[model samples]
Target: MFYSNSWTKCLICLIFIASGNAECPKPQVEGNVVLTNEALLMNDFPEGKEATFQCANGYLKEQGSERITCTSGKWSTLELTCKKKDCGAPREKPHLKYEFSEEGTLFGASARAICDKGYQLTGPSYRQCYATGWSGRPRCDVVTCDKPPEIMNGTITEKPGEEFPEYGGVIHYSCNEGYTLIGNKSIECNEDGEYNSLPPECKDVNDIPLKPTATISITTTSSSTVPPTIRDVNDIPLKPTATISITTSSTVPPTIRDVNDIPLKPTATISITTSSTVPPTIRVSGRNNCVGEHDTKSATENAAVVGIVISTVIVALIVLFILYHSYKRKGSYQMGEDPSRTKELLQFQNN
Candidate 1:
C-alpha cells in the first residue's frame, strides 16, 4: 500500500512539469508561410533548440536555413524566405499573337497563340511555361501558292521562272497574232496553291470569216466638227507582215489584214464627179461590223475617194470658167478691130 501511494504521487508531478509551464515561447509563422494546422502540441521546449519551416503552395524556398534555432528565452530571427519565379515576356512572332492564361508568368503556366488572316502558323502554336522560360518558339508566315499553269499559244505575265506567287497575286495572259484569247484574261493565285481560273486558250482569228464594210466621209468645208467617231473592236496580230489588196465597185477590204498589224494610211486621193443629176453612191456587199477597240484612225479608203471627188469637181469648174473668159475676149477683140475692114474686104471679094 505504501509503494502504490508513492508511485501515484510521482506521476502527478511529472504531468504537471510537462504541461508547458510557459517557460519557452514557441516559434511563430514567417513571410506568408504557415506550418502544420495543428495547435502547438509540444509539452515543453528547452532553450537552444530548433523547429523546421515550410513554404506555402506556388512558392519556392530561398537559399537560407529552413529551421530557426531557439535562443535563451526567445526564438531566432527567421533566415528562410518563400519567393515566386518569374518568366519575363515571350518573343514576338510576325502576324501572330499570344496571351497567357494567368497574370503570373511562373512555372507550369501556358500561353495561347493565334494567327492573323492570310497568315499560317508554321511552328509550334502554343508555348508552355518551364523553370527556364517558355518552351516553344512559334512562327507565322503568309499563305503560299505554287506556280500558275502554262498556257498554249499564250504567255503568262509573271517574273520569268519565278516559282511561287503568294495569295492574291495576279497573272495576265496574251495570245499570239491571229489568235484570240479564250477564258479569263487574267487569273489570281489563291491560298489553296491553285489559280482562281483555268489557263486561257488562243483561237485563230482567220478561222472566222470577215465581210466587207464601207464608211463614206465627206467634208464640204474646213470645219472643226468631229467626223463620225469610230471605235474598232478587232484583235491585234503578231509581226512579219504582208500587204493584201482587193478591188470591187463596193467597199474594198484588204483580205487577211493582220489583226496585230496597225492599219496603214491611205496612199493618195482621186476625184471623179458626175453632174448634179447623180448623187454619190457607196455600196457595202457584206455584213459590216467593225470589231476593233484600238483604232489606227488614219484616213480610210472611202475617205480618200470622197476627198478626191470634191477636189476633181472644183478643178473642172475652174477650167471651164477660164476657157469661157478667153473665148469672150477673143470675139470682142475681133469685132472691134475688123468691123470697118470686114465690109471693104467683102465688097472687093465679090467684084
Candidate 2:
C-alpha cells in the first residue's frame, strides 16, 4: 500500500508541472506594431514571459509602452500606437511647384514637379518620400529657341548679347531700301520656343501702279445760210460781220483772226473747241479766199502752219528793206513811179 501511494504522488507531480508550463500563441498586436527579433524566433511564448515590440518599416511609434506580458496562455493587451512617417514638404526651387500624390507627404508617397510660366522642368519630374527624405533632384529652366528664320531681302534684329532668343523675347524685322514689309514687323517667341508666325516678306516698291494720263479732245462747228462763195482779189467788197466762238484749255488768250484779213459771208458762224495744252492761233487770207466748214483743221496743225507762214513773211520783209535802201543810195528810188512797175507792185500787195 505505501508503494502504490508513491506512484500516485509521482503522477500528480507530473500533472502540476504540465499545467505550470502553459504557453501563449504567437503574439499579435494592432496597427503596425511587430515583435522584436528575439521574440519572433519563437513560435509561442511561455506563461509569465514578456515580449517587446516596435513600429514596422516606414512606421513610427506614437504612444504607449513597447513591452507586453503573457498570462494564462494569452498575451496582455497592447497600448502601443503607430503611424506612417511624414516626409514634410519638398525643397524650394526657382520657378518650381510641387503637388503631392494621393498618399500625401508620408513615407512612400510621391510628388510631381511643375514649372512656372515660360519655364520648363528638367530631369526627373516625380520624386518619392523615403526614410532619408525625398528622392531625386529636379530643376526648372527657362525655355529657349533657335535662331529666327531669315527673310528675303530682310534682316532680323535681336537683343544685344543674346545668342538665341528666350521665351517671351521679341525680334524686329526690317526690309532693304526700296522694299516694303509684307507682314508684321516684329515677332515674339512662344511657350514652345518658336516664333509665333512666319517671317515677313519684302516687296518691291515698283510693283505699285500709277495714275492714268489725261486725254486731249477737239470739237468744231460751223454755220452758213448759203453755199460758200470765193471772191476775186480785184473786186473789193464791204467788210462782212463774222461770229467767232473759241474754246481752249490754256489760260492764255487765243489768237483770233484779224477782221481786215478775213472776209466772211454775213451769215457765217464758226465755233472751235480744243482741249490741247497749248493755245491755238487762227488766220485767213483775204485775197481770193473763202472759209467753209471743210476748211477747219486740228488746233495743233493750224498752229504749226501759222508759225511757218509768219517766219516766211519776216524773211521777205528783211530782203525788201535791204534792196530799197541800196536802190535809194544808187539814185534809182523813182523806179516806183514807172507805170508797169506800179501795176506789178499793186498785184504783189493784193496777193
Q: Compare the candidates by lDDT and give the number of the best one.
A: 2
What is the C-alpha lDDT profile of model 1 across 136-182, one tens digit per residue?
Answer: 87877777677777777888765334567776778889897767876
- Runs in model 2 with CA error above 4 Å? 1-12, 101-103, 208-351
- The weakest ten consecutive residues by lDDT in model 2 span 259-268
Root-mean-square deviation of every model: 22.0, 23.9
| TM-score of every candidate | 0.40, 0.52
lDDT of 2 by residue, 1-351 (tens): 999999999999999999889998888756688889988887768999899999987889899999888887888888889889999999899999998889889999999999998899998999999878899999999888887778888887654246788898888898888787777788888888887887777877565344333333446545443323334321222234345555744332323343222222232233347332322233443323534343333433676898999999999999999998997675544654887887776678569
Residue 110 lDDT in model 2? 98
Which 10 successive residues of model 1 have the least lDDT summed?
A: 274-283
Candidate 2, 344: how far from true, in Å?
74
